[model samples]
Target: MIYISDKAKQKVDALRAEGTLASDYFLRVSVVGGGCSGLSYKLDFDNETKPKDQVFEDKGIKVVTDLKSFLYLCNTTLEFSEGINGKGFYFNNPNAARTCACGDSFAV
Candidate 1:
């Protein structure tokens, strides 16, 4: 299962209230081929649930991923950072053997 960190939850809340995203919209996290690493993470707000989709929630934030992506994301945590260096969502993935410096790509 995937988890969401407190900081990420706050950012998601703020994003939901900003615009475009409605109550039904949820965080969609997926992994795709090609990056500095072998795989890259993709995140967005989505309202639709596809067949065999895996859904998980943490801190009132709902996250969805397709079955294929779920294999690479199990036991992962989604976090957000707002430090002087940078501000963005991060994937703390236990399944990843290697990850890019930006933390956006990984290889398992």
Candidate 2:
């Protein structure tokens, strides 16, 4: 299961409250090929589900990922940072052997 950090939950709440997405929208996370690292993470708000989707909920937020991505993302935590050094959502993934400097991509 993928976990959501407190800061990441807060950020997700703020984004939802901004009224750009539908009320039923959920966070969709996927790993796609191509990046400085071999795999890149993609995140977006979605209301639909695919046949092989895996779902989890933490901190009142629901996150979904496809079957293939789940293999690479299992046991990961989604975190958010707003410090001067960097600011955005990142993953604390135990399965990753290496992550890109930007923290958006990783290789197992």
TM-score against truth, every candidate: 0.94, 0.94
Error of 2 at 68 (Å): 0.4
Tell me the whole-model lDDT of each prediction, alpha carbons only: 0.91, 0.91
Candidate 2 lDDT, 1-108, residue by residue in tens: 989999999888898789777679999999999889899988888999998899999988899999999999999999999879755998899999998888888999
Q: Which stretches of candidate 2 lie over 4 Å from their true place?
A: none
The CA lDDT at 93 in model 2 is: 91
**Where's the lowest-lDDT run of ten residues in candidate 2?**
14-23
Could you tell me the TM-score of candidate 1?
Answer: 0.94
On the 0 to 100 scale, the lDDT of residue 65 in model 2 is 100
